[model samples]
Target chain A: MLRLIGIGLNPKKHMTLEALEKINDSDEIYLELYTSRIVDMTLDELENLINRKITLLDRKTIESEFLVERSRKMKVSLLVPGDPIIATTHIGLVISSIQNNVEYEIINGISVQCVVPSILGLQNYKFGRSVSIPFPEYDYYPESVYNFVLENRKLGLHTLVFLDLRESLEMSALMGIDILLKMESMYRKDAIDKNTIIAVISKAGSEKQRAIADKIERIKERDLGPTPHIMVIIGSLHYMELEALKKLASFPENENINLL
Target chain B: MLRLIGIGLNPKKHMTLEALEKINDSDEIYLELYTSRIVDMTLDELENLINRKITLLDRKTIESEFLVERSRKMKVSLLVPGDPIIATTHIGLVISSIQNNVEYEIINGISVQCVVPSILGLQNYKFGRSVSIPFPEYDYYPESVYNFVLENRKLGLHTLVFLDLRESLEMSALMGIDILLKMESMYRKDAIDKNTIIAVISKAGSEKQRAIADKIERIKERDLGPTPHIMVIIGSLHYMELEALKKLASFPENENINLL
Candidate 1:
């Protein structure tokens, strides 16, 4: 049997009891950190918390058939950061399990997508489709991310922007801000500008989590500690939502702003 | 201080360690079940698991100043059925905390929105804004829910439809199908029909959870056990997603399907 379990944000405290039980029952456990990083958690600390040896799987090993093959013979569990299967690559494993006739289960966890809205005092149903800002390389920047934001804005829904995380390279909120600004310059559609309001949440679901909502220019200058940050582009805001943003996210009061 | 803690779907096995610790440290722990129900677990079973007496709060009490007033003097935790703050009423508590000078923290959990996609092997990012179906009353049926599903479908995004749970009353999947059919007749947008493909997930995140995807007509005939059911209206499906649905969700192989 194979199980894809989510270890939420903080490995020390965010794992569900079912996740712990599954981890304990597995013959071999693997932890995948290429898709996301756990805040302030070392592999050794995680190993100690569960009191089991964990084999770290890189992207190549995870996507390969090694896990399926192992699960066919014995129990194997892959501990994912945040919710399992949110990353498309994990879906490949489920498909492989089916083809190989290896029974598999998905154990859910606290996702950043859900946590961000709760922490920011925003309604979850008010969020539109989430977008990811990939790290732009030479001649390889995709504008679909910007277009998705526009589509969400047009519907008066907030957009959760996921920063890029390619193996060892993690994108920070500052880097994401620069990418958005660059997109604005390239497209000139006025989708994003220094004056546009955005919320940058750092270390979400952790004790050190900090959220700051302000215009692009000032928000980019502020210090939102640590890695694994997600950004939210505000759309329409209700009066209570606006008040919560002001109190919880350090959003400045602007009398000219319109409310839904 | 007041902390809004999410017990996820099943209180027995879905809570994080942070949730347990906070519940233990809290001077007063309250569980609000009027919003949602815990599958196969009684209130006594939950109280026994936590080894503490829990005070139940209804909608009126939960929205009232009672919680904030008590938290002002001692530590208090409201054990929510799912991820805290998704209900919007809980956001009111956060706003009240700010007004009453009480510190608050949100401990995130595995929400149904995150869990349903994983169970069905659908990509989370492809889901648009979620909508809820209310129990239709005399002269008070809302077509906005139908419109939201149409909007999501236009974008080729999956719509997670929440079944209405009004205190002591729960709307089942059969009832939801009837309502959607009624909406289709009213709108004439061809949004939903007897042949439309939809997925119904019952008792999600629990041991007895079951998911089935098929034509709306056939799916409604099958027995999907218990309350707290959620429905997903299908959109464009990736080839792998279709394969996963077939293998995991009992979706039939249809040659006349389009893949993205």
Candidate 2:
């Protein structure tokens, strides 16, 4: 039997009561940190709370037949950062478990998906398709992020731009903005310009959560403080949304902010 | 200070450890039940766990100045089903709190938006705009729903059809499909037909959660059991998604389901 649980945004603040019980019941507990980071707790703190030695699984281990073998014989629980199935890879793993006739359960938790909008006091319905902005590999700069922004902007919907997190190196919002700016110049499309107001949110759903709303050009120079940052490209903002940004988050003075 | 907490889907299985602690620490605990229901636990069971009598607030009470007034001077925790800020009205309230200088904290939980996709093994990236189907109020069939389906289908994206949950009456998937069918006839846009494959999910994120995929006409005959039923309009499906529906969920035999 395999139990996949989401510990939510903050380890101390968000673990569900059922997740805690499952951690106790499982014969072996493994934390899959390759996908996302646990922003709050350390491995020692987590181990202390669970009262068990937790084995951390890298990508190689997770992709191997080790999890399947262990689950087939003993109760195994894999702890995910957010909701277990938010990532397509996790969904693929569950499908694999189904093929192996392994009984499994998914315990969902809070992801940056809804929490980011909630923290900013924006309507979830207004958010369109979310896209990830990865660190450009040699001669492989993806334009999916730019395309997603353009599509969302056309529908007057907000776009959630997730900066890529690779191992210990997480892409910064400044670099993400730089990529978009470069993409704009290369494509020569007016999807993202200097005047565009972008919201850079860091450590969302955590105690140190910070949000900054400013023009893209201006944001490229500003430090967003720490890793795990996401950007929201502004579409048509409601008056209340504008007000929420102004009151709760840092929004620069701009007369042309309300496109709605 | 006011803390708006989402108790997740199932009370017994989904409530977070932090949510429970906040419920105990709050000067006043109010359960907002107008937007969504707690499918697994009764009111008595919830109250028993909290060790405090919770006042259930109706729509009128929630919209009124009661919550804001109470939170102004005391620590109030409003227990909302699923994520606290998933609803737009909650965003409005939080904005009001900000205007009144009332400090508030939002605790995120497992939302149906992510959970449904996770349960059905549908890629979240493929989900387009989500729309709710309200019961027709005699000569008031919303063309917006028809338009949304057409738009989403054009983009090759799945649509999450949320059934309207009026005060005491929760609309089922069968009734929702009926509304969409009538709208299609009225608009004649070819958005959805009798042969359209829809995923009817009931009691989502619960232990007895059931998902059935079939043509609309066949789904209308079967009882999905209980309130809080949601439907997913299929778009392009990955091979793994088709396999998930066949193995994880109950789907009628269809060669056309694999759109990968």
Best candidate, TM-score: 1
lDDT of each: 0.86, 0.81
lDDT of 2 by residue, A63-115 (tens): 78788779998999999987788677777788888889988888777787868
Tens digits of lDDT, candidate 1, A1-260: 99999999887778998999999999999989987878868899999999999999989999889999999989999999999989889999999998999999888888887788898899898899999888888856678888888778878889999999886777988888888788778877777766667888888867788898888878867777787788899888988889988998888876356789
Give RMSD to native, each candidate: 1.6, 1.8
- Over B124-144, each residue of candidate 2 has an lDDT whose tens digit, in order, gives 777777888887877788887
Model 2 lDDT, full chain set = 0.81
Off by over 4 Å in 1: A188-190
The residue pairs found clashing in candidate 1 are: none
TM-score of chain A of 2: 0.95
Which candidate tops lDDT? Answer: 1
TM-score of 1: 0.97
Q: Output the worst ten-in-a-row residue range by lDDT, candidate 2 chain A.
A: A250-259
Each candidate's interface RMSD (Å, one decimal) is 0.8, 1.4
Candidate 2 lDDT at A130 equals: 81
